[model samples]
Target: MKYEISGKKRFSAFSLYTLSFLSGVVMGLTVAPVGAWFLAWIALAPLWILIIKNEKLKIKNSGEKSSFLIALAWGIGYHGVALSWITGIHPMNWLGVPWWPSLAITLFCWAFVSLWGGIFVAVWATVMARVAQQQPWLRVLIGTAVWCGLESLWSAGPLWWSSLAYTQSPHNLVILHLGQISGPNTVTAAIAAINGLIAEAWINRQYRNKYLAIASGIFITCHLIGLLLYSRPIAQPPAAALKVGIIQGNIPNKIKLLPEGLRRALTGYTNGYLTLVDQGVNAVLTPEGALPFFQRDLMRTSLASAVQQKGVVVWIGAFGERGRSYTNSLFNVTGNGEITSRYDKAKLVPLGEYIPFENILGGIVQRLSPLDEHQVPGLPNQIFDTPFGRAIVGICYESAFPDVFRRQAANGGQFILSSSNDAHYSAAMPLQHHAQDIMRAIETDRWTARATNTGYSAFVNPHGKTLWISGYNTYETHAEIIYRRQTQTLYVRWGDWLTPILLGLSALGWGVNIFWQNDGNTELRS
Candidate 1:
């Protein structure tokens, strides 16, 4: 004799919660560091099943509340489990706050930040639970839409991280080629659609569902196309080449601004630039905030010596003050010792670069801050003209956003130079940041040279392959044959084309659901 529980009755309330959270944890592991990309293909299957397998009796009275709560739990699980490395930073304690209070503040801040992604997951889950009342096939398309839409909006906002597609970056060469077709959203949508089919198949306990077969077929077809694309040669007779020198100074953020630290940074940057110039680089680029002060302070004898060496343009990251506000900027010293072609950072790190609601909440956070933090944003799409070609400058965190590069490339940028200061972050953060650039490179078909003030400085090709990679805690310089790409991708020409279509499909499904609800047809039949 055997006993088996069925549907929602199979698991207790606590057991369901654990299952929901586990789904999210699996999803989180799909991203960088862990990079279990295969898990992303099935991560949401359990969550989808959790929503669909519930009885109408349970959903009717409290489905909205239940769905919202479950999604929030999933968000907490994914973000809380994945980004727990945030606690390692202990940003408040970095400000000299007491250990106890710092711990409290750190947890609170992490939860607050996690809510950004959590809210999107919550919305997606809520809609899926409601849509579960409808056709199973419709659930597949709408569910995919919901996830793609959420990632689309989130990537545009201040708290942007790698998109779900980014999990496969720099590794999954086959699926990663999808970025060349429709940006990262294509891969993310494909994953979501597959999971949706898997969920429906599981709900009816039919492993041989045609929907599952179709989804599988699509996945395999896309991979095959990706393989064909990957096998092709990347260096298709480049129009021009720009040899850039990337300087990585292994300096900690804590001492980087101190007198001795500033001296060391200046010395390290100058030496690196001069060495690369002697080796015949067209230009030399340093990491963000490599020079703590303004342009005048950087006009020292060492800098002059760098300028005097040759016509090699020296691009230094400095603080540019205009009236009361200041910008984290990049500029060049010409052969005539003239400063020109300046690009300021527009996208800022929400808390690190500048505090939000500073006037109202500034008092409370001031005690936790090590120093006054204020940096003004610059105008968008500032492409600097160099002898090699036009270059786009994405300072620090801004490099993570694809549109930042797209806009610059559209404005006629040929090559990409990203300057970052990531010393304050933990071990996993640099790799995460690098993954973003790899996607950007694939999308725009541009060569990317990322110079950071500690680690993860590398040269990436248009095929999203790492040409050269470096380690942390070392002063080093890299010179590579960087190609200038004037070619525009479909993604560059039409930005986020999938997002609105996905959102529209979700809206149509939601509208239909609303009609069914008003007509008292909770059970959607075809």
Candidate 2:
């Protein structure tokens, strides 16, 4: 079937797909390090318009298939641009892999990750096309709900970053504050609804004024509500504040595990710790893999001796033994030189930390990762009970998963400690990683002290403000006073309650659409 407006020329399938891809690229630009955040408000409008057009015109025999292709194009464009930092893994000659094979691995990784993210968008588009005949308001609700639901699903996967909500981080504080209510999904729903409204207005020119007015009202209302949430204080009186030190060793990824590099790291971290202790810091934190040695070997370091002599707590990131396997773990050593608590990283980076199919890949895994053996993941819902308070910890890629922090927060985490090693990638990856931490800070309403091996080490307040950040590839030690708040935000207490409700709404919309179609109710068709 073909349908056309009186004065408008219909777009070819190729043109529509290209437009969708470009629209997604625009949306990706809205995130860091580009930081063109305002573009996000309307960046998705073109893709939504394309989907609506394809659905209305019945461009192909299978509307769902065509819609999926269109949305998949958008997803590829978005992820490809946003996660371009993945290509930084190229030139792995330093890791003993040849130049050409290293390039192939890097490109493969980029395409694989982008395609994984694109699949989620394609699934949402396929289901959304089924309910295209519904009223504009109903369609908007169903679309936003389904989109948020899919995002929640993506979060459950092993690799997830580039959330729609992170687009507003560190730039648009008001919109980001909505995260406190129900995490990033709330912000994502708002963004999707607004784009849906605009698309409806564009497609239905006869009721353009009404649709635009409704969109405007919603835009203003979301911001106003966000302002209300942002203005309120998250911390209560009598909060215990701790002066903590963060160490950025700036160790290059190539030689981090080498003997000479080990000596340099030990001397650098030990001196940084003593310097911070001289400044009267209560505790010090190191980045992930900063020690890069076993727990037993870490105790012999000068840094451990300084901690015991200075009688100050030190949170050190090192390797731990779990029976026969090794684990990327963080240890909390008290002034008495005893390891009081340890949290192993639950989410390991694919290829970087462990091979996915060891039985199949075999020796190929060694060529890719620095580790000879796979690191075992820690159990879920682990939190460190320090002298100050219960601390929520995220190691490297684990910061991308919100629920990891949310669960710990719900279990009574007073503060957040994110330990990362961003030396493998360029500045773009760390900037985006830092944005995720900001969103976590707002959602959990906890002060965050992030330490990185290379750069972007900083302190974030409960409201998602970065109080201090270090330069990239720079060796530095900074101390800041961060309060430990027992107060939990609505998101923490209620969890991701919105995602499940949205998923239910999506299911009902699909079921109702199917029922009406079976009954031959043409009246419900738009």
Candidate 3:
């Protein structure tokens, strides 16, 4: 059955799919870099209307196929646009990958990841289509729950940086504050529920007024609560504040692995550290892989000697040896230049740090990865103990996962230190990555200091404000006063308590819907 676009106009299956895809593209534009955050509130309405209104065709197998395809199209557009930075892997001739092959590999990676993301949305649409006949309230609840549940599940898997919550980060600070209650999923659920209500109002003429009223109430209430949370004072007057320095070495990805690059990195970080020390900063941070050498090799360098002579604490990102394997790790060096603490990266980038199915793929996997050897992942729940206080730490890719930072805060981390190497990608990745840090700061109520190799080195307060940020591809050093507070937000105390509840509710709703439909069908047959 063709879907009606208006009173007389109609949309064919292809038109519906195209429209769904376009709607997703619009939603993608609402996220970071572009940051048209308001668009996110209504961006999914068109797609929802298309899927729910088209349920009349459910008697035919074509209906299921069409719904899945439409949602898949939408997902592809959303993830494709939001994750467009994946294309930066191209021109890998620097890694010895030829031109055409490099372009092919980059495009393939982009399409593969986009397709994976699209699959989650398609599954949600397919299930929701079965319940299109339910009450608007039920539909909205189930839709929001399923969406949040799937996002939580996706977060547990690999490659999940484009959550709906991030659309508000550093832009809609009021909305972002809701993350303190139940993490980013709370914000994601709110967005999904709002869009679901708007779509229901647009499609259900009988209940349009009711749905709109409820939607407005929810929208207003969320902002009000957010305002209260955002304004609530978490700062401690007696808490000690440390002057921290962030170093952005600005080394190009091409030469970063070469001998000359190593020398430059050493000099750059050493000079940045000495300068910051002169400014009276208590601690200094370098980006991930800023020193490509292992800890043993790094400590012998003049940089380590400088730290000892100056008697200032420094957090250095370098490789750590774990038996036969290497780890992407952050080391905490004391005033005496002794490595007192270390936090190894838990979330490793697939095919970048370590190859999956290495034995099966053999030499082919090496060609795809830039690393000389596979790196071992760190154990979970690692925190860095510094002179200032206990600190949450995240290496390059770990910023995308909220639980990593949450665990640290719950375990008594007073502040956050995220180190990254974003020199491989364009400005888009670093900016988005920075936005993720902002959300983490608000959620855990911890001041964050992020140091990156290329750019977007930043310091964010507990309120998701970027106090200081550096430009991309520039050598820069900045210091900010960050507090070490022991206060834990609800999110840190409870840790994503909403996800399991939402999943259970969605499951129960689905089961009840199925049982009710069966009972009605039995009565009709009798």
Write the residue-wise lDDT of candidate 1 on 1-526 in tens digits.
1111253354555676777888888888876678787887888888787776653436433466666766777777777655665665565443567878877877786787677667778898887767777777778888888788888778777877746787777688688777777788988888888888887787766654776787789789889977876777766455577788889988777677677787788788888888898888878888998888776677775766667766678788888876766789998777777786889898887766777898987787666666454677888757788667788778888876778888888888887888888777666778778888888888788888999998899998888899998887789998988888788877888877986887787678778877877677545543
Q: What TM-score, computed on C-alpha atoms, does each candidate reach?
A: 0.91, 0.95, 0.96
Query: Whole-model lDDT for model 1 versus the true structure?
Result: 0.78
lDDT of all the models against the reference?
0.78, 0.86, 0.88
Clashing pairs in 1: none
Which 10-residue span in candidate 3 carries the lowest summed lDDT?
A: 55-64
Count of clashes, each model:
0, 0, 0
Model 1, runs deviating above 4 Å: 1-5, 55-62, 91-101, 236-239, 367-373, 506-526
* lDDT tens digits, residue span 1-526, model 2: 3323223676666776788889888988987779898888898778777676677776445377878998999999888888989888888865878899988889999999888777878887886677677777777888888888888888887778988898888799889988888989989988988988898898889999998899899889989988998888755454586999999998897788788889889999999999999998989999999998898898998889888889999999999998878999999999999998999999988777777887898576676665565688999978788878889999989888899999999998889999999888868999999999999998898999999999899999988888999999999999999988888878989988887887787678668777877678666563
**Candidate 3 collision pairs:** none
Candidate 2 clashes between residue pairs 3 or more apart in a chain or in different chains: none
- Sort all candidates by lDDT, best to worst: 3, 2, 1
Model 3 residue 259 lDDT score: 88
Candidate 1 vs candidate 2: which has greater TM-score? 2
**Candidate that scores best on TM-score:** 3
